[model samples]
Target: MIGPAALTLLLGLWGVTREHSMWRDEAATWEAAHRALPELAHMLDRIDVVHGVYYLFMHGVFAVLGDSLIALRLPSVLAMAGAAAATAATARRLAGSRAGVAAGTAFALMPSTQHYAQEGRSYALVVAAVAVATLILVTLVDGRGKPGVPARRWAGYAAGMLAAALLNWFSLLALPAHAAAVFMAHRRGATRLLTRWPMAAAAVVAGALPLILASRSQAQQVAWIRPLTWSTALAPLLLLTVGLLCADLLKRLPATPPTPRALSAVSLGLPLLAFPLLALLLLSLIKPLYIDRYVLYTNLGLGLLIGAAASALVRSWRPLVTLALAAFAALLPLQLDLRTPQSRVDDVLAPAEVVARTSRPGDGVLFIPSLRRDTAEVSPGSFTALDDLALAQSPSASGTLQGKETAPQHIRRAMLGKHRILVVADVDGHPGSARDTVKRRVLVEHFTRCADTEVRGRRVQSYERGTSCTAPPLRS
Candidate 1:
């Protein structure tokens, strides 16, 4: 357990700062965490209530650590380390000491696990909580028919589940997976587990109900998620294929001394790996909410199965060590790539750099679609020289991730009054609101593009007022 946790921590800390760049999502976290408590609460009341718990936790982290990028991300690194340890402990109890080490090591090395471990988001914390919950469930199942099992074990499971759910509501999907494990245990004459599991599960639901209700009104926050397609299945299918192959390899080996049916790696790991993912995929068919990060704890199951298979191989073949080394060699490029700023969708600092290099004092700035304001929010020093032409209220004052903007007519007047303006927008521009249409139309008709640069997924351009209006109007 210690070995895997230590390995995970080392991997997470290797490139924790990503060249001092933050993507838009991490920028969102930074913006929210830095806000005053009342402002953060107000922002949650209006948007991102889904992340309210995580943002609140980060608010406290920043309060103590002084809001550095490392402070923003270190909690996730530590959480993932805890997850690695918990995965090891759970595998050890069900399999053996060797299997525990193998499982924890496998989990620490997985690309998905490593990716979230370094992110400044709730997903890593959610994984840690769910991993701990699984460990507790395994303990309870193992202790069935024993005289000294305490109620606190169930309480611990409930608390873990509730924490996971509050961090991200989609974590509730783990309940069905847990249900499958408990059902399998009950079928093997552990009937009392059927009753006890429901009580714990009910507690989780009741505890999470308030967040669920609050987040329902913020549904549009995820409107950007497209409906599912065949491509969506490719990643999960690949992971499932590898896991099943591992399971098959274990099956081919001489069976170790019989364990409880429920404790078998196949029985527990298969359901844990498949159920939540399948449930989410199916749910996405109704409403497109299936993102792999939401169910990252499934990696725990995959790690357990792989570890068991690796343990069997080590016992049966001397070349197993060579194979492990070769596997790491093959994954080296991807591991390194995941540490770079380009690994993320967009680097908020890149555009901010462009703005800082090109703009002068009193130059106006515009964020097409408005949310690109995150770049400025993330690196305010770079933007301090320019005026935000459209902003009517600051993000904190407006209780928004992006500040509220002035009226469309007022925005157009503000733009026209400036001699030079810097525009920060998406590479493929969004169809924006009437206000955005006004900003675009005025820029295209009245301003000449003096310079333009694309960095990562964002575009930053400098515009100067032209002598004559000749360009066609921009589409909304």
Candidate 2:
């Protein structure tokens, strides 16, 4: 457990800063965490209430660490490490020490685990909480019918489940998987678990009910998610395929005499790996919420299945060593790429640097679609000297991301008044709203594009009011 945790921590710390870059999501975290407590609470009341607890926790992190990139991501690294340790402990309890070591090592090497371990988000912490809860569940099942099972174990299990669900409501998907595990254990003679598990699950539901209800009203925040397509399922399908293969391999191994409390790896691992993912996929048929990151904790089950297969081969050391090396070599490229800035959708700092270089004092700034205002909010130093022509209120004050923008006519009037305007926009120029369409019309009709440059996933343009428009309207 210690070895795997150390390895995960070292991998996370290797390129923790991602070359000093942040993407839009992390920028959101930074903006929210730096706000005053009252401002954060106000923002949550209107938007992103799903992340209210995470934001408050990060608020404390930034307050103590003074808001460096390392500070932003370190908690995730530590949480992932803790998750690896807990996963190892769970595997050891089910199988053996060899299985535990193999499981933890496999977890640290998984691309999904490595990716989220360095991110500034709640997913890793949720994974850790779920891992701990699953471990406690295993312990409770093992102790069933023994003299006086400790109540604190149930309390810890409830607390862990509550923590995971509060961090992300989708984590409730874990409950059905836990139920399946408990049922399987009950069939294996742990009959008392059938009664107690429901009590713990009910407590978790009671604790998480408020957050689930509050976040539902803010459903529009996830309105951008499109219905799941074939491409969306490809990665998860591949992972499930691998986990199934490992489970099959475990079945073919020579059966050792079962212990009194022993549960088959397939019972726990298959439910953990398959249940949450299947639930989300089925739900996505009605609404598009099946993002891979939302159920990242499912990877722990994959690790356990793979570890159990590796444990079966441990008697023949050469096969285990060869397989481990082959797996590492296969994953090396992805591990390296995860540390680069391009791994994310957009590099927020790249456009901020362009803004710093191109803007002059008193120059007006505009963000097409307005949400691009996140770039300015994240790196305010680059944008402080320029005037924001469309903003009617600040994000913190407005209790919304990107702030509130005035009416289309008011935005057009403001743009017409500025001699020079700096525009930070998306490269593809997604047709956003009627208001953004008006910004493009005014720019094309009245301003000449003097400079244009494209960064990672954004375009930075400079325009000046002139006698005739010299360049075409922004691309759409």
Candidate 3:
């Protein structure tokens, strides 16, 4: 049991946790957690309502430990370690010991698992909680030939559900899957357990109502998500395939159906991986709410499927499975790639470095639509002398995940006062809205573009009041 978790911790710690740069979401967490507690509470009122619990938890970590890359993300690393251990215990309870060990090992090697294992956000913790809850549920339901469960185990299951739900509100979506797990775990006559379990789950849901209601107003956070597409839709299909494979394999023995425990494990894991994803996909067709990471906890079941399948495969050709696992564990190239800063879509490092070096004293930096203020996330001190021209209130004071926007009149005044202005914007080779429209109109109408450089996710341009386009461009 400990071997699997130890190996998992070693893998998670090697390069990724300490080496990779914080991506946008993690940067968001960094910004949220670094604020004063009162300000953080206010910020949660308007934005990141769904993540309030996690942000608050990290806030404590920041308060006590002080902020650094390691300090920020160490919680997630530990969470993933817990997730791996719980997965092993769940697999052990359901299948045999080999399957338990295999599941934990597979989880550690999974790319998605590794990605969140070091992430600063709450996803790793969410997965860990969900997995632990499943393990307890399996233990609750796997009492074959026994009539009633102990009162303490029932309390544990309810508490687990509450923690899982609070960790990430979307995790409540897994309740139906857990309902299926309960039903499948006791395929015969266990009406009492089934009845009692859902009542406990309901209590958990009831406990989570305040968060659900609060976060409903923050739905705009996901407004950028378009309805589901075929490409994004392949994932659930693949998971269902795994579930089907498990089902197919379970039916193979001619002399006998699988024992109650084997049946329970397969039943719990299959739905655990497949059902919620299918629901999310279907719901996404209606609302476009599907992000692979949103339901990241589902990977718990994926690891189980892989382990169970691998165990089945290993029985036939033990050498093949052993070689594959060994190769995966030793694959230095893949691990290194995962650890690189470039692994993220918009690594803040390059753009931030360019701005730090190029920006001079008394420069005015403006973020179009005002969200790119986060470009300073890694090198905040680099911009300490520069004015953030469009911000009305700081992210902390405004109670916003992103900083508040200044009125157009105020922004125009700020632009007019600055001799040199730097715009770090999402130019994406496109025009702007009323806010950007105001900034662009003021800058181009009054100043000359001294220089403009494109960075990964943004455009950085410097404008001067009287310079000409034909004039020699200043150093970038």
Candidate 4:
């Protein structure tokens, strides 16, 4: 278990978290943590409610460790590793040692797991809390060979559940899955679960209500998550299938009926894997919240289910080796891709660096929608020579990812006064605002495009005052 958990952390630490540039949201995380606690709370009241707790946590991390990218993302790496260990522990309790190790390995190897393992955000912490809560639930139920849960253990379960819910309000969905597990484990009476689970479940829900309400009012933050299409709708099932296959394929699956313990694990794992996904899909029919990361905790359930199957199938070391080799063969490419700088929506540093290197001292930089200026936030002095044509207030003053924007007319006037400008924009520029259109209009109508280049999912270009604008001189 320790080995697998260590492997996960080491793999996440390998290259990318530090090397890849911060994206917009990550820039948000970085900026929020540098504020005074009261200021951070005020910012949370209006925006980024979903991430407030995470920001607070990162604030503490930054206070001590300072703000290197690795330091910023280290908490997530540790949380993911803890999630793997908890997954292993839960699987071990439900099945045995072989299943536990297999489960942990599967979790560490998941590309989604790897992706979030290095993020400086709430999702990995949410997964860790849920995994630990599930482990506690298993302990409370199984009691090794005893019949009932102790008060101390029940308290622990409540604490764990509360932590998970606070980390991400959507993790409250785990309540129903936990109820299903308890019912399956104690189906003969369910009196034990009925007596204990409700108090904890209610506590978690109650505690998360403030965050849920606050985040709800800011729903526009997720306006980008469109109504699900078929392929996106099928993703959870595909992930579940992949998890099971990863384990079961190296050795033959069991033909015999599962024992009561195995049945209990299956019940818990099934709901963990399915309920959140189903709930998200159903909810999206109303308000569209179907982003995949929201349900990332389901991967642990998949690992447990597959580990249980693998335990039943593998009686020897050869089969275990075969499973390990098979998993490596399949997940290597995903691991490689996860480590790439282009793994995110874009390399934010590209535009920052391009603008820094290309623009002249008096040049202006125009960020369509203005918020895109966060691309340069990662490096404070990187674009200081160039004026930000649309910035009204700095992020520090406004307590936001992008800060306040200048009016379109002011932006136009500012732009008209500059002879050279650097432009950084999203590739398609979807959801362009009226102001964004005006900014684009001013640039194209008055300036010559000296150069334009695509950086993964974003575009970086240079422009100059018309007529006098000629091909840029060559440099060695």
Candidate 5:
């Protein structure tokens, strides 16, 4: 009953959470998905990505849904619900009905879980698969090493793990933790599992090969032109872990009697907290890819541990503690999502709408190279809202003018044919040499700013060709 109720609540929250705008990354995914199949393949090959499977998945998703916000985000919400249910079922089997219900509830209300659930990418799907795989692995390990642990069960778990790896490369980070848990569960059975490592590693390699080739061929695109500091990357990870800890506390409350509260709490919390940290330390020792979303697979352990603990605590203060912690976890995220949109990465509708409203039909679209520094290149039909317009590729270097040095002749030719042009550029600060002599000479000599407009919060400079503008900016 608690499990079903918790599932219901999580599903309800999904409806409300879906109401926000898309961030830059979601726009990128949509742009890639909406491309023609051949072009899409080319694009993926050219971009350094560990998750090419998402591009293929979104391609199918958009084919049916028509690229709307609801269309983009619905799959993620469903995936999250699946994850919540799986977590509950797994927790229930390992602990008890009380722990199972609490785990599901805790997961449903988690800010990070909720955050990704509303996205349009592969994280939610990966998390869902991870939960299912975790459940199967746990079942296999926790059950007495009876000869009856079906081969089909192991096969199913392997498939899920492979699929997860394909969906998001970060899912690989959880492998060591999962393997350690499995080995500990059936010490003797560990030898058999070890025998299967060759097969498992092969599947992972096969699944990841496409992404690897795509990355090598296309080169990874970095949105941040500047190097990122360790501090900036670490801050989000720390904050996310703290949020998960608080939610876990709520999940550990006791439901019915006959459960030893203190003993259960320690048993749950120590393993939940310890294993992930150990995993992180191990990863850091070799090479650290400390992204928050990458760590999401392990979140199941935390949710389960907390649920078990909360069930234990429920022996004393049942309703109040349960409700308070649940409320606290749910409220912060709800408010943050509502007031500050973009908490979920896949809400691309509002930003796309902004692009549509600001530009006009036949007006030339200009993308300033500096703006590209933010990992957001305008979507394929970014100009569709305004008009069926041709685009002028701007210089990607910071503070550089479009058509500076390399493309003076091209810009010169473009200006001769297209008189009405909008120069679009993101003005966010990036450290690079200022506008070079070529751009300065071209702007001063050939074109003059006619009207200025802004799209998606960037300043666009409209330029008209001067009758006396004869020589190309580069030649000048």
Candidate 6:
């Protein structure tokens, strides 16, 4: 049962492994990891991004794999696969083999997990690490085998907890919730272990210190999410926690057994499931830092809670048929949506591709107004930069008539030094400039607008200063 469930998951993941083209964030990861160590460090110092561990991990990944879309996302794929396997094991530990099978199978089909697995980001990897850590913690909490726990297992869990916290700061919250859940499950043993694991607790505090200090510095970068409102605050917490619970519960009913004990077990689990989600909801109201994927690590717990709930509902063949039809109808649209990810890469390809093909590997490719996280994601190996500029407002380059004020002089130095230049802007989306304003002002001077170039569903107007002008404007 375990082998087939894991195999089915691997096969399903293989299907979406290369579905979407490489988007911008994935590109940034490739660029960062592929560069010299010193160069990567210098860039990190400038940006307020606190993804140092991810940067370092990708540095090694890129060293071995080179920078291709498949290579960039391979780590995430492997991590999601690990999470699937771990979910199965964790379920078996918590419930029984039938429950474990259901949990693993449901995890493999989860749209959210599948979505992250296909991207080249740290979330999926973090999810896997969190799952392992959660499993270890749960084992300790549940007092599965130990009348008194082994020293080595305690040490191993201490190390794993610290590793999970460092991997993604948000999982720090998830880890504690796991400990709390374990305590609720086995109060006496968990209490004794907590007292014994003082050293482990100390290690966690020490490991989190860097993240604590870095949080102050990272304040400005994520300021966009602050000043929480009631609706915005509650929405993400509910979505991350309850949403997964509901999805998993619905997905697992087909395998449930109809018995009173099953119903009683589910009833017992509900409050245990809802508490931390409520805590997150309250915290979000105060801080407004909630994001749907931030609590992604909890999806493992959610899968189990859901599977347990479904297992409770199973009684007869009639209930099984009804549950299967309902689950299929509900998840089919979601599955289709995930199987076909919205390709921002397709949308923004016009200028990126044109620059990619035309520019030499060493040549500078500058974004007039600084690129978004997505646009900044283009491969550094493919297009070096003279200066990567983010304009304060768009429509005109700095110093242009349509622009707010003076463009930075440093930009002129970079532009003039480069042998040629390529300019790209979404006709409607470019800031400070209306569609016509961009065409009339910025596109005319440094770059001549190409006849046919469109990116990401928007018309991609391109201008070139030094190169031959054979390329046409990108079209839809």
Q: Residue 221 in candidate 1 has what lDDT?
A: 91
* Candidate structures ordered by lDDT, highest first: 2, 1, 4, 3, 5, 6
lDDT scores for all predictions?
A: 0.87, 0.88, 0.76, 0.79, 0.57, 0.56
lDDT of 2 by residue, 49-154 (tens): 9999999999999988889889999999999999999989988888787788788889889989999998999999999999999899889888863558889999
> Which should have the higher TM-score, number 1 or number 5?
1
Q: 128-237, model 4: which lDDT tens digit per residue?
A: 99998899888777663245546777777778878877878788888898888877767644456766678888877888888787777888888988887788888777
User: How should the candidates be ordered by TM-score, best one leading?
Assistant: 2, 1, 4, 3, 6, 5
Candidate 3 lDDT tens digits, 1-476? 68568877877786754344666778888988888788878888888878888988998998889888888878888888888999888877666666777778777787788888778888898888888888877777665415566777778877877887787778887788888866764566654666788788888999999988888888888999988889888876876787678657745622121355524446677777887788889898788988888888888887776666556556543663575568586866777777876567665545676778778899998877566778774568778889988888777778875577878899999999988988877747344557778898998799998878775555788888765644567644
lDDT score, candidate 6, position 192: 59
lDDT of 3 at 13: 80
Q: Which ranges of candidate 2 are over 4 A from the true structure?
A: 145-147, 256-260, 316-322, 467-476
- Per-structure clash totals for the candidates: 0, 0, 1, 0, 22, 27
Judged by whole-model lDDT over C-alpha atoms, candidate 3 comes out at 0.76
What candidate 3 gets wrong by more than 4 Å, as runs, is: 17-20, 144-148, 189-191, 253-259, 316-334, 427-432, 469-476
Q: What's model 1's TM-score?
A: 0.95
TM-score, candidate number 5: 0.73
In model 4, state the lDDT of residue 1: 77
The TM-scores, one per candidate, come to 0.95, 0.96, 0.91, 0.92, 0.73, 0.74
Candidate 3 TM-score, C-alpha based = 0.91
Best by lDDT: 2
Off by over 4 Å in 5: 1-20, 187-219, 222-230, 233-288, 316-321, 324-326, 333-362, 370-408, 412-420, 427-476
For this target, which candidate reaches the highest TM-score against the unseen true structure? 2
lDDT of 6 by residue, 291-372 (tens): 6566676566666666555544563446644664576578776666655535333333335555566554334444433443
TM-score of 4: 0.92
